[model samples]
Target: MATPGGVEVIGTDPAEAQTVKLLSNLLWFGQVVAVTEAMLLGRATGIEPTRLQELLAARSGSSRLLERDYGTVLRGDYMGAFGIDRVVEQLATVREMAAELSVPFELSSLVARVHEDALATYGPVAGEMLAAKLLEERSGGALALERLHEE
Candidate 1:
């Protein structure tokens, strides 16, 4: 079946599927950090309220699009069948990205801790899915940042 962006879904091997999930999650998290940084920059720069409103609207639209994409992914087992090792790998990537970005170390550590706990409590499939969803949302937020930069 065609996914939201008109992309065809393919059956993925367990290992490859896990990698995709991890990469997707990493990209999504990066997007979130980028958007958050942009928002804070805009606020600090004292951008006019009207302009801020426009940016926010654009961000919201992008978020919806990401949500649709993520839903399509979840409907397939491509990532769902991944093992715990894959989830750990994905988390490590996220943590590394967060560190490189200088994303408040404290916050990053907290998020990592929480993610570890979630994975432990829920098992790999559920944990990975949740992480994937968050990443998807972040990707949308990143699109919003691109829009704002263009404007």
Candidate 2:
């Protein structure tokens, strides 16, 4: 049987697949935070955020998540495809799972806390990427870019 735009896994049980899904969400949250911090540092250090986005896009640092968020972040659009509250929830689950399994979750715990702070700061409905504002507020600099929406 053929799956449409999906992968077929052999011999992996439901519990393992659930783990994979949770880990994927955790990774995505980590990606948003990591790329936001990197680009925020660039802007704080006297670089244009858009240019930083361009350089990163061209360089080995580029990834799909980075490319996807660069424009939204630079433009300060908190339009939620996903919300900070939801990411925090997922991270919380991942954190609990880590504790139950005796896994080192220091980084995950930190990221989850960061998102919790972000949710508190930005409101529960704010976009997941709204956490970028946390960096801007901390740095006292703007991450604004001229938004270019292709019609």
Candidate 3:
């Protein structure tokens, strides 16, 4: 892939590639949980959630996932191009694999629970972004971008 004008593609052995995929997906699942908490915390402090996302994007808190999903969540756009059930299933599978490997995977466990809770609350039909609904419940407010400008 590197032959394609500086588009680099690093190859890993199968085991490492699977490990990388597991960890990468785990990070994605965990991030939604973390960002949901961060938004709720920011709201609790009277800062608009969208403003917090902007501030984070300009600071060390930024990440491609955070910047992208932050808007999706704040806009109340749960149009999960991907299914929540699949994500939750994957998270559960990873956590189970970790356990069977006798590896400590506390964060994976937490992420699984968070996603599971979202599914329980919103049902299987809801978007994977239902993670934000947990925040909405906690903050007693909708996680919508329009609310940010009013503040």
- The residue pairs that clash in candidate 2, if any, are none
lDDT of 1 at 91: 66
Q: Write the per-residue lDDT of candidate 1 for residues 1-151, one digit (tens) a residue.
A: 3357885444555555545665565555443333334444554576642355356646753553243333333232224445544556666776786678777556545545544654565566533444433433444422233333554
Best by TM-score: 2
Mark the regions of model 1 whose C-alpha exceeds 4 Å error after superposition.
1-12, 48-53, 56-89, 93-151
Model 3: clashing residue pairs? none
Cα RMSDs of all predictions?
11.9, 4.2, 3.6
Compose the digit string of candidate 2's lDDT tens values, residues 1-151: 1259687563457677667778987887877778878887776787877888888888887877767756777776755888788888888999989999999999878778778889998788858776677766676665775432321
Clashes of 3: 0
Instruction: Give the winner by TM-score: 1 or 3.
Output: 3
lDDT of 2: 0.76
Between prediction 1 and prediction 3, the one with superior lDDT is: 3
Tens digits of per-residue lDDT for model 3, 28-116: 77877788888788878889777888888888877776777668878878657867787788888788888899999977787788789
Clashes of each: 0, 0, 0
Estimate the overall C-alpha local distance difference test score of candidate 1: 0.47
